[model samples]
Target: MGPESAGSAQRSHVDRLYHLPMITPQGGRRSAMVPDVEVDFGAGPTTVPSTMRYVDLTGNGRIRVPAQGAVDWSQLNKLPECITVEWSGADRGVVEAVAARQIRFLYWHDASGTVDLTGTGVTDVRLDGIGLRSVRLPESARVLLLREPPESLEVDAPESGHRMDLRLFSRGPDIRIPGGLSRVSELWLKVAGTVSASVLTGLTDLEELRVSFDDPPGVFADAQDLQAHRGLRTLQLDDAYDWDPGNLPELPSLRGLEINGTRRATATVVKARFKATDVRISIHGAKSEAWLAAHMSNPFRDWVEDSKPFGAAACEAYTRARSAIEALAPTASDRMAVAEHALRGLIAALNAIDAEYQLIDTLRREQAGEVFFELAAQAEVPVDQARRWFADRDF
Candidate 1:
């Protein structure tokens, strides 16, 4: 039959059985059938019983369903293992159906209102859009990404060996990470509103953390709580306004720390606090002597250490360039002259090295360019002027 005629027949079939009520797992009643639906089980669309009309099985035990109207999903003979639902409004039956079947992975998009999966066995969930009033995930969840901030959120502690990597974009003051979720190992929070770092109290196992804010008071409220994560190895804090770094404890495990767009005092304090440690610190927006010294100590340390036997000349050139930049005077004009001469010398040295070793490939050239610009930045050369500084280079 043609598509229109088949659709009409399907509607007629569902209309005849629309009066039948299906009992949900919660003991509530809802319509047994939805009309004019096709199930695509990976291969192609196929006709299914009217009672299973709204659900489209897309193979590998994954199903796509709509949340626009009331339909009793519990009536299905078999439920898919993974489900993606585009929700328009609150549907307690949908949540109950997922909970009843223990859906493993759920991608709920364009949803609003509250959804509490407190007792479900869902392991992976990705939620998007705004207007979420509250959400509660079960302890079984291991991977979660919330694209919009919900007003209230609660997540149970994740099971061991199933560490969760959570990324949250939050702008609501009410949103806070519960201490119970201590097993979160990697977290990224991009905030526009205030969020307390007290949330990090019990996340002792966190190895990497990144926090960025949108405006003043950009830092977390009680950022000192970060010290609790003794295992944290990498941290990036951006747009930190008036943050006091003195309270930040020394993290023995920290190998890399990047602080960008912070106040001068905070940057200086961070430089002082982490200098003696072997941590690689990258601070942006501050041209203080400390920042320059920390970054310039050896910009080419890795390259020099890993250089091949044939690349001795290139390594020496890199070392010489670094030395010249480090000795630059504090004045901008003196810095410009010293940096330009050092860059020219490095270029000449690289040209001679490439002539003999053929080492200046596209990758090497890009790497050299990055190092050059970083040196320029360290010299306090304006970026536009720095670009022109390299205009005459031959290498």
Candidate 2:
């Protein structure tokens, strides 16, 4: 047996220890450093004067570029740059300090505008970031930012050909913003830490996507599976126990996916396959029935649900405990005194049990069946033996 096979029996540990690509600083530089290209930026260009260099103009921040004649932030490099300016605060009369970091610009192809945002010449403006809320281009129209807790940067513009990169500080990972993104192909999300979004619903043509989050400050969902990315060929979802991502992308053409986290991505059931593999994948949630079928080479594999038995058991226990406590309600008797004491005890115990299960989910991977394994581990028991597990699952 090779190193992969020899490690099979210990896959439970290996499954938790997934392998992901190490992002280099140079990789991040692409998104950070503003390109030095010289655009003719004709007379009408929303251009930046030579004096608009990076400066501590604000006297309090790292870098600031004050727009000269209607600042065109679209010319910025594909990275996180803080646009330090001022805006109206909640109290309209108050002058609020505004810093649009992780801003994005999208080519407004629909209703075109003029050189300025007044009529029909300035539609050339393009900004698209998750943290972007209301940025009126020309003056303060180009940059966007998440509401609170700063994030690094994430640009998912697959068509832009921009690499999956960003300038991340030690504490980075999430950017909250508006939903419904179907037109703009360039996607950027800052799940810098855990203060972020759960599902990226709009990018349908995406062939590959990589998400990085604080392993513990993860986001959870009600039911949407991420693998729903219709034409995705690659996926990388990593996080900690706190990261509660719902479903894995249910992609059929997925050639590879690299994942890391505490909870099993609930959406692992969509039938999918890949052209090949590069970075190893580590799955822990309810892996899709179609995935095993492809891996085992037995397209007819009957798969089992990989829900955490511990979680279910705890849930059932809580239900029973609640019913029992409710039964002792002093409704039909004059035992109101004991009822109060009993009810408190029941509530406390139920809460304690719930906490216990949550800890288990954090400390280790949810237990799965024998045939199942994380994508990261190498095949050991001949690809055929694994295929058999899928066939016998139904019976």
Candidate 3:
């Protein structure tokens, strides 16, 4: 398909905005470093700037350039390992500049046209809201996350001892696995159309695989092809339709299997097939209430289990929060409002018990955020609004 068609598919597939956290210095302070000679791209041609603004000097070594002006990179005294450029008109010169500096992580937003990173030392790359028709990656590239699949992709094999992680979230039916991605260890394909057995041809080292169909009638062509992936440990299938699990290979290394939004009969067959194995299976959507109650436990129960005598207050607080959310009327506005209130209550309870440190020190804040999002999703809350429920959180 053409870029226009692919772009349309992307919009439908990803209806939610992802708010990625930026790395900042401790105490939430940021110092701006302006370029030595700031040349206006809108004006006549001039020398490339030697320095750039918004360079994170102290923390994780990052440079964030906005989409307003042209950035012709010049040699800097200190180059950051992570660079984020939010320009839709970035071209080959930008790629060359980044390649020369050997950036480690690159987050390019709203990039357009073609760009090649032939010999860059970048280990991780994330392309979000891109309009590129093609992209070429160097052999040193390890992790690639694409919000929209490009019309053409050329990825060289990773260096020795390095494995690639390829994630593509596309709604197009023409999503093809590139040839040189044989070293990919983790693959996530959230797309449409039939997934042929040839798609797994060289993915022998794949450890984790997740396939989610965006449209109905899209199916996996063959289950026998999965036998080659002996290292596969985790497999997730979401919104799967017209797919059979009866002939699935016996993956001895499989530990976690999840099948969501599929036919109830299919789910039952899968359960029966893996009932004797040690694999932890999770089947949801179009399932019985009894099955759901038995399989899906409270999100905070694990936290309560991990904490003992000192966690009594936290357990009580989380229990109340869960109850509050569960008691909300099945309305979007009510869910959003009640979820926000419950989250604030939980945070207050934590602060009252002098356990706020646990939220930060033990990463309980992330857990709490995920729990709230899960509850919100279950209630059909829009992801963007649900995400904002935690915006005013104190803990």
Candidate 4:
């Protein structure tokens, strides 16, 4: 038999499943049969004849295009499939053309540099480490996995249509989420710097939110920011264990709350506050009684009490350290190390004061003698002054 006869016999199974169109002339069909491309898309296996310059595996509803320098989709008649566009070289036109074909899913991987998916009819997109500057996700977009920051990002949402459920992993001191796309239902932001609450102001209809706060106050400052989210149901506060219950918002719509890194005193208040409320609560890293005992044993807490004389000394130390750190040039690399050391001292002083205050507050509320004497002896003030202060107290 001739080469064409053998090629036809080899491709007979794949041809029956997916017709591999011809790209070469009938005379040269013999040489084209040398290399056949096999692809698997869940169902089983199918091969493309070497004769065709391109293959259309979209018949099975999935397409995996390797990183070719440039691809002509028109060669395969532009089938509507969930296209996986892997990073090869610059192929803006190829991506645009595929999007223009109104494909439902676009899995963009390893493609760096600026990418603009403005008019893409893609509904679900999984983007990995793409330097996305101009991002205009279609209103049809429902799910998105954005794992890296674009130099600049702007989402152009369709005026009247479906909303997007986005998971963004971007870090910054000034992270900007465009005011446009307001239909985000669920948003999970794993940010490095403190993200302003204003970023989510327009997403009023948001239901679930998970965020990491370098400073929890940034999110708690505006009550209306979370209160305005009438549809909000779940909120996960990551790295907010140090947060006090007083800073927590009164979101009537909130049903589930998750808090991590909670101090024992703060955790107690949080649990008490949420007990009567319908919101289900979960707490992690809550300090145990032993943790409280450890603090009580420290002499610094006793010395940092609300006594006016102690306050005066503490204030001077804190102010002096802060001023010394601030005097250094902000741009200097050594400034951070100096500032960090100064801040450490300041934090220790502040923590001592906070522990003393928390202990006093707990004693006032619970009226337990054990709470008073635990750190009362550690008070750095004169023994006589400490006695007078503790004796006069109604605990």
Greater-TM-score candidate between 1 and 3: 3
Encode model 1's per-residue lDDT on 295-356: one tens digit a residue.
32333322322234323566578778878888987865666777878887787777776666
CA lDDT, every model vs. true structure: 0.59, 0.32, 0.59, 0.51
Provide the TM-score for each candidate, comma-separated: 0.44, 0.30, 0.52, 0.47
TM-score, structure 3 vs. true = 0.52
Provide the lowest-lDDT 10-residue window in model 3.
Answer: 11-20
Mark the 10 consecutive residues where model 2 has the least summed lDDT: 88-97
Clashes of 1: 0
lDDT of 2 by residue, 63-115 (tens): 33342333333333322332222221121111111122322222221121111
Q: Report the Cα lDDT for residue 132, model 3.
A: 63
Candidate 4 or 3, higher lDDT: 3
**lDDT, model 1, position 161:** 19
Question: How much is 152 displaced in model 2, in angstroms?
Answer: 22
Off by over 4 Å in 1: 1-88, 92-105, 109-123, 128-140, 146-153, 160-162, 193-195, 263-273, 283-395
- Model 4 segments beyond 4 Å from truth? 1-68, 72-89, 92-105, 109-121, 127-131, 147-152, 160-162, 213-224, 284-395
User: Among these predicted structures, which one has the highest TM-score?
Assistant: 3
- Please give the distance, in angstroms, between residue 38's alpha carbon in candidate 4 and its true position after superposition: 3.3
Q: What lDDT would candidate 2 get against the real structure?
A: 0.32
